[model samples]
Target: MSATPAGSAGAGDGVYRTGYFETRLAADPNRAVVWRHICDYLRRWIPADSDVLELGAGWCDFANAVAARSVTAMDLDATVLKAAHAGVTAIVGDCTDLSRFGDGSFDCVLASNLLEHLERADAERLLHEARRVLRPGGRLLLIQPNFRLNPKEYFDDYTHVAIYTDRSLTDLLTSLGWHVEHTFARFLPLTMKSRGSRLSFLVPWYLRSPIKPLAGQMLVVASNPAR
Candidate 1:
C-alpha cells in the first residue's frame, strides 16, 4: 500500500489519547488473546495467503493475530505504529479515504468496532472504499456492536455517531454492491472491557455455540462481486 495524506476530520487523535483505551479498553493482554481465537474462527472466510487490511486497527489486535500473507493496519491515531507487530505495516490516516491503496490491492478488508465511530455518510464511504480496494471475490469482514441488541449501551462510546443492526448493515453493504455472504447477529460480547471478554479461552466455544449468552456484537461478511 502507498502512503496518503492524513487529516480527514473524523475522530481525531485526542480521543484515543484521552483515557479511551486506557480506561475503557484496559484489557490489552486479554484482548490480544481473544483476538487470536477470533482470528482462528475467522479463517473460514479469510485465507492464510490473502493480503489483509484492517481499518481503525486500534492496538492492531486483529492485524497482528490474523494469518495473512500481508497485513496493513490503518488508524487515525499514530499509536497504531507502536501496536503493530513485526510483519504488519501501520498507517495513520482516515479510514473513509483509502486512496493510498490501489484498486484490488487486498484480498480482505476488516473493520471491527469501527463503522459506528463514523457518521452514516462516512460509514458508507468507508465501505465503498473498502470494496474498491479489494480484489474481485475478496471479502469484507465487520464485527460491530448491534444497536438492536444493545440499544442502551450502543451510545456508551462518545465517538459513536451512527448505529447499525445486522439488517441495516446488510442493506448498506448491498447498496454499495457487495454480496452479503454471512450474518451472525450475536457473535461476541458488546465490549471487550467486560469480564466476559476476559474469559478468552471460552471464545472458541462461544463462537461455535448455538446460543450466545451475552452477545451484543454482530459479524457481517460480504464479498466483492466480479465486475
Candidate 2:
C-alpha cells in the first residue's frame, strides 16, 4: 500500500485513505487470481437471494463477486461511492456507526481485513452495528489477520489498531450476544498478492485441504442472537 500523505483526509480520523486499495494491489497480479477462488469459496456459504452488506469494502472485490440478490458496499472513503462494480450500490459510512441503515435490513454482512483498522471501542461498536443491521439469524462473515500468525508483521500497516486471533474474535462476538457459527483458525495467506507466486494455484487447494499452515488470516462466521 502507498504511504498515507501527511495531511491526507482521514489521516487522524481513523478511516483508510482514498486510493489505498488500488495502490496496495497494483504491484501484485496474483491477487486477482486468489480473489477469484476466495470469492467462490465464500459464496458457497452465502445463501442465494439474500441481501448483503459489506463493511469496509475496498474496491468491492468480494462485494461484486458474491451471489447475493442485492449488494451494498459501505466504505469510509467516498472514492468508492462513484465507481463501484455493476449491480453493487456504494455508500460512504463508518462501520462503527451505521445508523443510516435500519435494523434487520440485511441478510448478510461481510468484513475482510477490516477489524484490525479500528480501536477496541470502535471495533465493538462495529460489531453491534453489524448485528443490528442483520435480520434474526442473519450472518456476519469476517476475514481478519490473526496476530498469532503474523505478529511480526501485523504492525506493518500503519493504520491497523486492534489485533485479533481466532479465540479472541470468537469470544468478542459471543460476548456481544451473537452465536459463533463457524471458525477457521487458518484460512488464507497474509497479503492479497504478495509472499508467494504459487498462491494463485494453491488457494483453491488449501481451502479444500484440511491443513493451512501458511494462513496468516482467519475466517469467523457468526449469527445474530436468536430471539
Candidate 3:
C-alpha cells in the first residue's frame, strides 16, 4: 500500500507498478524461505486450522507460506493475484474499507509493512476494519518498521506517511478495543532489502536469538476481546 501523490491515479500510483515489484522488490526464492520461517514463528498465535486474511499483502508471501485452513490476500495491487500461491485467494481492494468481508469472517488478520503506507486517519480506519472482520478472541498480527528504532530511515520509502513506535501502536490498538497480547520492538531488520535479510537460513535462528542485531521492525499481536 504505497502512497500516490495528490491528484495522481487511484491506489497503487507511486508503488504497485510492475516495475516497482520487478525492481524494488525483485522476486527472490530466498524471500519465500524467510517467510516460511516467519509464518512458523507466527503460527503460535495463528492456529493451523484458522482462517486468515492478509491486508496489503504485497507479493502474498505470508499468505502463501502460512499454514492455514483458508487464506485470503487483499492488496490494492493487481499483481497480488498473480503472486498468490495455489489455494490462496487474492483480491485487489482498499484495505481501509473491508466492506467486502463479513463481520467476524476471519480468525486472524495479518498486516506487514502496511500501515505506514497510509495516512494516520486511514491507518486507524484500517485497524478498526480489521477488528470488525475478526471473530471474538481472534488475533491481529502486525510487522511494521518502528520509527523509534529507525528514525533516520523511517521515511526512506516515500510512501510511508504515518509513524508508529511500539508504545504508540499498542496505545492505538488498546484504544480501539483490542487487547494487546505481545509486542517486540525490535523483531526484524528494517527492510527486506537489508543485507541481513539475504541470509535466509539465519532467519529462524534470528527469531530465537535474544540479542538481535540490525533489528528495526516491530511485531505486535493483539486479540479481539469477547463482546
Candidate 4:
C-alpha cells in the first residue's frame, strides 16, 4: 500500500484504528467467500449510474466490483487508500464527520464491517452523517458482524470493537429517522460444534424471513425518509 495526504484521524492507535483488509498478510478462504457475497449484493442493488460513498474502504475491492459512475472510497489510513484502484478516489477521512462534503452529497453510502469498530455513540453519529450526505430517498447499505456467529472466528480480528444484533441495529436506524427497507444476514457463521453442516444456507433464509430475532452479520438497507 502506498501513501496519501493524511487527514484528521491519526495513524496507528491500535484500537478502532486498524484496517482488517490492510493488515491481513494472506487471504483467508472463508473471509474471501464473505467478500464475494458482499460484492454480489452490491452489484444487484447498486445501479451502474449511482454515485457511492464507501466508508472504511480498506482496499477498494468493493469499489472495483460495483460499476458505479463515481465512488469516493474514504478511510483513515493513507497507506491503505493508496492501494485503491483507478475508479475509486481514495480519500483519507473519518466516517463519523462528513463536513468535507455538503448535504445530500451522495446517492448511496456503504459501510461494511465498519460499525463494530465504533463505539455505540460514534456508530449512531456515523449513521446520522450517512443520512446527512445521502440524497433524498438515497440508500444506506450497512453490513455488520453478527454476535451469534462464533466470536473466535469473526471477532478475533484485533480491530473489532463490539458485537451487534439485528433488532438493536434496525431500531438504531429507525431511531435515526431512516426507514429500513431491507434487513438480511450474510456470511457463514463459524461454529465449533458442526463444521460441515448446511446451516450456512439457513442463515440467509432466516435473514430473508427471520424466525429468530438475531443473526451473524446483519445487512441493513435503509432509505432516507421522504421529507
Candidate 5:
C-alpha cells in the first residue's frame, strides 16, 4: 500500500455513498450482527502482517485492522473515504477498472458485503479485476450476505442488485481461473470467535469457550494459482 495521487475517476456520483445502516437498520442488534460478521470475516483470513486491498470499502473499519502491512482502501465515494479510519490510504476509485495497479499488486483482497450490489455481469468483471491485481497464490476473502437468509435482510441495503450462494461464488471464481480454498456458511459466529480472541486475552476464561453458529453470512477464500 504505497501512496499515490488520489484520483476521483469512477467514484460514482453518490450512488454507492449512502449511509447503509442509518437509512435502513437504525442501529439495532441485526446491524450488530452484520458488523460481527464483517469482523469475523476479517479475523479469519487477514493476518496482522499482510498487504491488503479492500474493495468498495465504505468507511474502512476492516481496512483499519490490517496489522501485517498498510491497507489500500478504495471506494467510489471520496466523502466515504474522508470518513474512513485514520490509517487507511483511502483511494476514490472503482474496482472494475483497476488499471492503476500492475499484476500481483497485493497480498490479499478483502471485499465485504459488496458483490451483490452489482449486476451479475459487473460482478464477474469485478472478480476478474480482483484476480488481475492479486499476487500469484494470493487470496481473495469475501463476506457476502446469503440470499437464503431472507432477501430483505440483504436487499434492504439500497445497493444490492444480485443474490449469492457459496456454490455460485465458487463457480464464479473457477470461471475466472482461481481456486476455492474454503467456505464458511455463517458470518456472525465467526465474528464471535474473533471477539472471543480479543476477550480471551482479557479474561482467560473466554479462551475455553466454543463458538456459536448463526448462519447469515457466507465467507469465501479463493486463490489464484502461483505463476
Candidate 6:
C-alpha cells in the first residue's frame, strides 16, 4: 500500500501487496490468542526492563504482547500505526535501514517472520545496523521460516526473496560479528494458520522440549561479542 525505499519486501509494487495485508488484518481477532503464546515464549529470552526493538513488526502483534521496559515496533507498512497497541511506539520505515535511531539504543532486536523477505544485501545491512544500535550484551532474536524443512511451501508467498536454515543463519550471524548464543532447528509451526496455532496452551510444553513436532520455523538468538 506504500512505496518504501528500494530493496525492501512487501513494500514495492507486488500484486498481492494490496489485499495481502488486509487478509492478515481480518485474522487478527483469532491471531491474538497465538500472539499471547508467542509473547510468553519470547519472555524466556527477553529480560524485564530490557528495551526491545521489533523490525518488520506487522500488525505489532508480538510488540504489543511483549513485556519490556520499552518497545518500538517498526514496519514499512503504514497499517502498523493503526494495528499497533497504544503501549507500543510504532513507526513506518525500511527494515534494512535504521537511520532514525541512534547507536546503542536497545538491549534486544527482534524479527519474526521477517528476514526471509529481504535480499541478502538488504538483510546484511539490517544486521549491521542492528549491531550498531544495540548496547553491549544485547541480543538479536530471529524467528524465521526454515526453508530446509518447509521447502514445499517456502516460496508460496511471492514476497520471500531469501532462504535460510539454522546452520546457514548461524553462519551468517557469525560472519557478521555476532556470536550465536542459541539456535533451535525446529521451533514453531510454519504458518500462523496452522492447526497448532489455535492450541496456544501447548506452546509452553513444546518450547521446553528438544523434540518439536511439525515444526517449520527456526529460532536463532545471537548476541554482540562485546558482552
State each model's CA lDDT, in order: 0.85, 0.78, 0.87, 0.66, 0.64, 0.81
Runs of candidate 3 with Cα error greater than 4 angstroms are 2-6, 11-15
- The lDDT, on a scale of 0 to 1, for candidate 5 is 0.64
lDDT for position 52 in model 3: 99
Ranking of predictions according to lDDT: 3, 1, 6, 2, 4, 5
Residue 45 CA error for candidate 6 (Å)?
Answer: 2.0
Distance (Å) between predicted and true CA of 20, model 5? Answer: 4.9
Question: What would the per-residue lDDT of candidate 2 be over residues 1-227, giving only the tens digit for each residue?
Answer: 11122354652243354345544534344655676788789876678889999887766667767888999988776655654688999987666778999999999999998888777777888899889999998999999999999899888777676789999999999999999989998998777555674457877888888888678999999999767
Give lDDT tens digits, candidate 4, residues 33-93: 3444446656766777889998877656566556688988887665445656786888876
Model 2 CA deviation exceeding 4 Å by range: 1-8, 11-15, 22-30, 195-198
What local lDDT score does residue 94 receive in model 1, on the 0 to 100 scale?
80
Q: Which candidate model has the greater lDDT, 5 or 6?
A: 6
Query: What range of 10 consecutive residues in model 2 has the weakest lDDT sum?
Result: 1-10
Better lDDT candidate (4, 5): 4
Per-residue lDDT, model 5, residue 28, is 33
Candidate 5, RMSD to the unseen true structure: 6.6
Per-candidate total of colliding backbone pairs: 0, 0, 0, 1, 4, 0
Please report the candidate that would top lDDT against the real structure.
Answer: 3
Per-candidate TM-scores read 0.93, 0.87, 0.94, 0.75, 0.75, 0.90
Q: 5-79, model 5: which lDDT tens digit per residue?
A: 133124444333344424632223333334444454355566666778988776565665556577888876665
Candidate 1's displacement at residue 215, Å, is: 0.8
Q: How far does residue 24 in candidate 4 sit from its true spot (Å)?
A: 4.9
Candidate 6 collision pairs: none
